[model samples]
Target chain A: MLNKVVIILTSILLYKVGGKLSLRSQLLKGILEGCILSIINIQPAYGYELSVKLQQFGLSDVSEGSIYPILLRLQKEKLIIGEMRASESGPKRKYYKLTEKGQEALQLFTHHWTLIKGPVDNIIEQGGKTDGSN
Target chain B: MEATEIIELNNEKRTRLTEHNLKYYEDMLLYIRLNGNKSEQQTEEVLLEMLEHLLQAQEEGKTAEEVFGDDPKAYCKEVVEEIPTEKRKNQASLIMMVILQFLGFFAGSYGILGTALHYFFDIGSALTTFSIGSGLVILGIDLLLLGAFILAILKWIKQSTFSKKEIKSWVEFLQVWAISTAFIGLIVVIHFVMPSFGKEVSIPTYYLAILGVIFYVLSFLMRRKQNF
Candidate 1:
């Protein structure tokens, strides 16, 4: 009886949780990923450079693990390229440069965000509630 | 110090850079290597330039540990990743739930293809059975897929890095991709077996089958990359 009750409650809780994870969380991801894209436009950079610039822009939780993989994916997608060299310290140093594909992707992403941002703002302004913008 | 000696000393820990300083060295190394200058003097100049930038970054007032948030130049990912929702869905158990559900959608639907085949052969009458059975099975898979998709979303809601919402959207995207491929598979089945029945099979059916095979391989690669 206890196990049955627990399963029902758990399922209900899970459903409630799942339903809420929608546009907001992904939009946040888009913003951060887009920021990474825009930065790539300025100059080729490394993971640390990205992390640093992101923090300067008021992003606090960015980690090297997340950024490195995104860089790798961007490189794999032909959106970016990695330039590796032997460092004086002995570790291989990799720099990330934006490809034409990356530039095009960034442009499209920025445009999409602009379109979404307006309605999102209107919705939030309708109520003082926000989907965790900070 | 001689170039070789300097490198040896640096390696031996005489020039041990703190984690704080290490990333600076890396960036300068990347800069010098990429900017078409690799002479010792140019390397040294780039290193100094990077070191200065690192110090300047600090003077802007951010701690090393919270640099993702505090540093003016850190990646915004630190901010996005810190979202509380992403953390919950990243758990092995939850990720497993999504993987199982994702696989279950197709695994549960495999029988549909077989049923469709049995009816296609006798097409004189098996048509009713195949149409009815395939439709029902597709319905069940759709429901399961929908339930799991929504569940994946809810699971990722709060965390920044892998918020349940992102998971939900990704699952939804994957499902759409999966269903379309299943239809393509159905078309492929029709091409080989249907051609034997003397009906003119369309050319696009063959083309779609080819595309389906390519996408199947690509999907496998994507799944592997995601560790799904």
Candidate 2:
């Protein structure tokens, strides 16, 4: 009973503080990278633009700072290619485009996402049935 | 617009944007440097790319906080964590520094011990034992100091992040060069000016001074030309 109370209090404290993301965000990070790659698969983008696109997709917590490193890592892994090209607005911008490897990775992520999503969707849709039966 | 005109326009805009966000950018970069072990080149490239994004955000009328996020440290940590740790360069430099440090300590200890035995204990019969012994002690102190100085520099290098700014500024190089020149000048003045100072203008001293200047200039030029 004490353990349960402690757990409830700790969760309340975490929620009140609110800055820290739940465990879900930690799991979402890897999926976010793959999602970022898929976004790049649509169009080549600079880091900031890519970040804005992520925010547009309802990931308001995503920061521009987080994307550059991920882009660099993807480039290093040969999944994407970045090139410095002259921008009309300012100095040369490093634009990232998906490589063939990145496309393959995106395909793999999509295939895996579907596998997870289909079962989860079914289970979530059956939530009312389960509760009603209970 | 012509290519040159477009380039010039972009340059002007970038310069203006840099002026506005320079301090914010520098603080973030410094945080990265102090927290992580990264090569100077890697740091420079990362900064350059980051600056591009910062400029883009400025163009969009976004606040720095909005663009970089509230927790800059966490963002930097997240980015830095993605970079694969390179053992080769860190290991090589550490090995070289350790070797040099050991040599300094060994030589200093040897000098202190040898001089103590010869002069203080009178183990070796030498005529000018007293004066030579004092000089050896000073030499030993200098060697120990040199070792400590090198170790401090290595520690600073490990902690500090290097960037394009390091390359552009010649202050560090100039400080080293100035010290070298002043030391050589002082030695020459003492040898040539002071009548009682009987230290001859040795061939080895001349060669050493010449070699020091050559290396200094060569390194300065190389650092200027490329990211070292």
Badly placed stretches (over 4 Å) of model 2 are A1-22, A88-90, A125-134, B1-22, B33-42, B84-204
Q: Using TM-score, give the best candidate's number.
A: 2
Which regions of candidate 1 fall more than 4 Å away from where they truly are?
A1-26, A85-92, A129-134, B1-228
Find the candidate with the highest DockQ and give its number: 2
The global Cα lDDT (0 to 1) of model 2 is 0.59
TM-score of chain A, predicted model 1, versus the true chain A, to 2 decimals: 0.67
TM-score of every model versus the real structure? 0.32, 0.58
i-RMSD values for every candidate model:
10.7, 4.5
Q: lDDT per residue, candidate 1, B13-45, as tens digits?
A: 414445754553443233233321123322332
Show pairs that collide, candidate 2: none
Q: Which ten residues in a row have the lowest lDDT in candidate 2 chain B?
A: B197-206
lDDT of 2 at A91: 54
